[model samples]
Target: MSPALASALAAELTRRADEDRELMRQAETIPPPDHRRRIAQCHRDNAEALATIVRRHGWPTAALVGAPASTAALMILLHAPDPGFRRDGRDLIAQAVAEGHCPAIHLAYITDHCAVDEGQPQLYGTRIDPKTLRPYPIRQPRDVDERRREVGLGPLQEQLEALGIRV
Candidate 1:
């Protein structure tokens, strides 16, 4: 990757993070409907911009775009409203992970997100239900921790405890 391209991607990632943080900080103050709309709009816009980057540069692996920018790219895809787009991004991320270009944790999160979106049990219990403060569902609850461990994630219970869920 060209130095200029990397720098530009990093800058864009920083801007996206700043905007996301600001929106989240104001979420409680904004009415629920408006807050949801603003969040959705931001996700859509970021996903669209990331789509262009993906088309031009593929998955933007850490080696190509640096770790922070690559992780930010994954975050944008993870928050996308469109399930099809998210699944496509998941595939790209999975391939990148297989080739050691991206973090395994990225694949873990996106895999669970896509599965939940499709109404299927997630292979990794990485997605927690905010309402219940528990994992949404796992393919095999008994083996979920093993699956998560393979992907560099801690046990689901531990993760919940870390979140103050008292699991």
Candidate 2:
């Protein structure tokens, strides 16, 4: 990928992150009904934007624009209301990882999320409740720590602590 394209994508990713973060902050405040609406709209628009970019450029692998930009794209799509869009992004990211272009961690994260989204066992136990700050129950609880370790994720205790959830 050209430097210009990489820069452009990185910039756009940064902008999306800022907007999303601001929306989240607003959502945390009292009387955030308007912010809730704004967040939904923002998510829809961001999803469409990523879809368009991916359709044109395939998955933006780390080799294309650095890992930051690629991961940013992955994160935005993960929260998308449409499961199909998230799965599409996951497939592209997985292919890139297999081709040695992107990091395997991205696939690991997506795999867990997609698994939970599909009501199956999540390998990595990454998904958490927004309101309760607790991770969704993993399918095969006994094997979770092993799976997470394989994916470069830290201990579940550390992960939950980092998310501000005790236990």
Candidate 3:
């Protein structure tokens, strides 16, 4: 990546992350139902901004700005309002992984998040149950640990435990 491109990506991603944090904090003061909607709207707006970057420069590869930037970009897109964009983000992440430009962890995140968004059971247990505020059950619960390992993620059960959740 050119210095100009790298500088731009770093600055823009930083701004988005900062704005997202601010909005999430603001949303916390809002009542439920509306609070999540407010937060989701913030994500949608951020994702739209990121979409502009994607349109201008294409997928923000890890080679361009390191894995964290790439991961953050994918994460915003996963929460995008447009299902097509969400699906496209997932596809782009997969291609990036295939080309060795992104980590497989990015793919796993988008996959599981998109599945939950589509009302299917997530494969990696990444989604939370909105009502219970707990990690949602995986489609194949028995093999979730193995699947998580395949993507270099630690055991899902332990992660949930750390979150004050069981199973």
Candidate 4:
């Protein structure tokens, strides 16, 4: 990634973090139904912003990291341009959630290990496991396995290992 792109990504992540914090703060005072609705809207806006950023950057491979469980799902719903993209993304997210990987930790692994442009962490391949229905870290194979273990993927690990992923 070029210096300019890296700087842009850093700025974007910082902005997103800030927005997430603000959303959480707002959620604290809202009623349950309203809070859920507001949170959903916040997620939609964030995903839309992310989609725009990715599109502006030419649709680089993006990994949705974090434990919200809904992050990846929402991302897919909001950003994927077609039904196929949405289906694929949703399947992967389901696998990840089933395998007990949180979005943030999974995101860290992808960002740290993948060949992402320094400025654009959101433009990366979406790696999802078919059986576990979870997103795997594209960058750190070892960490992915470790995470699988931490999440108690005994049977699932066997299946993935058979596929040569070692998780």
Candidate 5:
């Protein structure tokens, strides 16, 4: 990515984080039942928007870090098995990567809140290892990027190379 594009992406990420945090803060101040539903809806919306963007870019894989509901929706849309249906997370991620789609992982602040307030990481940074079919926590964007480079991208590149998909 060009420097300008990279800068713009960083700015957008920061803005998103801020917006999510603010929304969570507001949700917390509200009463029960409604608060939970509102938060869930917000997350769902965010996830759908992210998925739409990913699809528009013609990428195959996306990792949802923080938003569990959103990630679940994505999995459904992608025809991946539901997390409760004995499906493997890693395999799904790897498959998407192999298909040349850019999988996205979401890291939502609500996770941190859940961790501190509820004694657990809500739904942030959760990743499924396509190879192992296990859940792994992706602590940061760099972590996901690195893993994609090491496991997903590298193998896919090798396969493409074998098929003569090269620069």
Candidate 6:
């Protein structure tokens, strides 16, 4: 891991996170369509930057880029519009997790996110419906908590409750 490369990645992650915070702050004041467009643009930009970094550095695991930047890289891929790109990122993270270089919880989030992006029922119930404040469809609802536990995530209902959403 080049120190320069790690520093650059950290800077990019910080900038992106700042932009995300600003977007959230402005969300209520901006027109809905405009807010959405801004968000889409932000995702596109972050995705492209992250894709380039990935092409050069693989998955940017914690060993390579530090934990926060590694997690931020995952987030950039998560918000990307292309389902295939998200799937590919998730696959890379899955491999990293298998090698003990990444957290299983990261894998859990991306796995459920990709499932939701592909219109399939989530395996871990990680993706929630913003409108309803509930998890999106889960493939095996009965086993969700068990699956989440295997990946270091708490129960889905507990997560929802943490968000102040009554389960």
* Per-candidate RMSD, Å: 1.3, 1.7, 2.2, 13.1, 15.0, 1.4
Supply the TM-score for candidate 3: 0.87
- Those runs of model 5 whose alpha carbons end farther than 4 Å from true positions after fitting are 1-14, 58-167
Write model 5 residue lDDT over 13-59, tens digit each, in one string. Answer: 34444555566688657898887776566555544544453444322
| Per-model CA lDDT versus the true structure | 0.87, 0.81, 0.80, 0.46, 0.40, 0.87
| Model 6, C-alpha of 84: deviation from truth (Å) | 1.0
lDDT of 2 at 4: 95
lDDT of 1 at 50: 87
| Predicted candidate 2 versus true structure: per-residue lDDT over 61-157, tens digit per residue | 8888777888788778776889888888889888898899988779888887888789877777788868777777686788888877876888888
- The list of candidate 3 runs beyond 4 A from truth reads 30-41
Best TM-score goes to which candidate?
1
Candidate 4: worst 10 consecutive residues by lDDT? 116-125
Per-model TM-score, in order, reads 0.94, 0.90, 0.87, 0.37, 0.33, 0.93
lDDT of 2: 0.81
RMSD of 2: 1.7
Candidate 3 or 2, higher lDDT: 2
Query: Residue 108, candidate 5: how far off, in angstroms?
Result: 15
Higher-scoring candidate on lDDT, 3 or 4 = 3
Over 58-117, each residue of candidate 3 has an lDDT whose tens digit, in order, gives 788888876677767876776678888888888888888899888888888889888877
Alpha-carbon deviation at 31 in model 3, angstroms: 6.4
Give candidate 2 regions above 4 Å deviation: none
TM-score of model number 5: 0.33
Cα lDDT tens digits, model 6, 1-167, are 67997888877876786686688799989999999999999988988888888898888888888888888887787788888899999999999999999989899999999988878999998888998888999997999999999998888888888889897
Order the candidate numbers by TM-score, best to worst.
1, 6, 2, 3, 4, 5
